[model samples]
Target chain A: MNVMYFAWVRERIGVPQETVETEAATVNDLIAELKTREDRYAAAFADISALRVALDQELSDFDAPLAGVREVAFFPPMTGG
Target chain B: MQVRVQSEPFDAGAELNGFAQGRTDIGAVVSFTGVVRDTDGTLQEMLIEHYPGMTTSAITKIVEEAVSRWTLADALVIHRHGPLKPGEPIMMVATAAAHRAAAFAAADFLMDYLKSRAPFWKKEITDQGADWVAAKDEDEDALNRW
Candidate 1:
């Protein structure tokens, strides 16, 4: 699976995208897995309320199932237009 | 319908003039352009970032909903990403319809949705420092009015 980050989250994570192999069942589960891997991930995921998730390019909830999902993106709330 | 996402600067008036061209059935055309404003006169640049794969699809869906809700002859959306000066344009929305009401309403709806729903982020660079612009509750609340 490919995981991505954007904006300040990307700056914190230090990478835009990465391919990860995981057994996570949901977006939150994946975040938990990543948090254990590095301090940067822990810091970025510290406040989930300040972040938003997208499963396969569509806006989705943290509890959204990751079954058959190829891409997951994490970022802060959009300030577009 | 046309949707363009680019970092290059664009002329909004030219884009508006070229939109829905030579269409006899269209009686009204409405457009809205978003410009970076330096409220405190201390801003240097605005940096915009967006998701690559999702942007086109998200915007297409928004415009399609507008087309279905209103009788539009055509529509155009252009959004830019990357660092931009305070006076530069951030984005533009244009809609053409048989009636003024439909065109006006559709354009307004497009702006409201684009403000909150698009997968784009903004950072303001001022004389003091650069900071990410937080999404406003008012932007989210604006969508409810549609």
Candidate 2:
């Protein structure tokens, strides 16, 4: 699966997107898996409250199932307009 | 309905003039243009980032919802990304309807949704540094009013 990060999360993670292989069932589970990889991932995933998730380009909750999701995105709350 | 997510600047006036033009059915056309506002004098530019694949789809979905909710003859949304100077246009929403009230309401509805619900992110660049603009609770609250 492809995991994308945007805005400050991208800055914090030091990358825009990456490919990861995981058995995680939900968005939160994926975040938890990534958190154990490195300090940067841990720091970025430390506070999930400040982030928003999108599953396959649609806004989704942290606990959303990722059964068939090809891509997942994490970012701060949108400040568009 | 039309939704455009581009990196280049757009002419709001020309867009409004062309949208639903010469349509006798549409009597009222309401437009709202959002400009890059610099809160302090030290601001240099505003950088907008968006999900390429999701931006158009999300905007189109919003426009479709507006069309279904109102008696809209037509609707248009143009949002620009990349770096934009102060006072430059960021986005514009236009709605056309048989009466002023419907047009006005639909335009307002689109603006509110675009403000917080859209996938775009805004970063303010100033002499100090660049920082991502945080979403405000009021912006989220504004959506609930409709």
Give the clash count for each candidate.
0, 0
Residue pairs with clashing backbones, model 2: none
The top-ranked prediction according to DockQ is 2
Q: Which is the leading candidate under lDDT?
A: 1
Interface-residue RMSD per candidate? Answer: 0.7, 0.6
What local lDDT score does residue B137 receive in model 2, on the 0 to 100 scale?
Answer: 91
DockQ of each model against the real complex?
0.90, 0.92
Indicate the docking level reached by candidate 1. Answer: high
Q: Assess chain B of each prediction and give its TM-score.
A: 0.98, 0.97
Each prediction's TM-score against the native? 0.97, 0.98
Worst 10 residues of 2 chain B by lDDT: B36-45
Model 2 lDDT on a 0 to 1 scale: 0.93
Quantify all predictions' global Cα lDDT against the true fold: 0.95, 0.93
Q: Native contacts retained per candidate? A: 0.92, 0.90
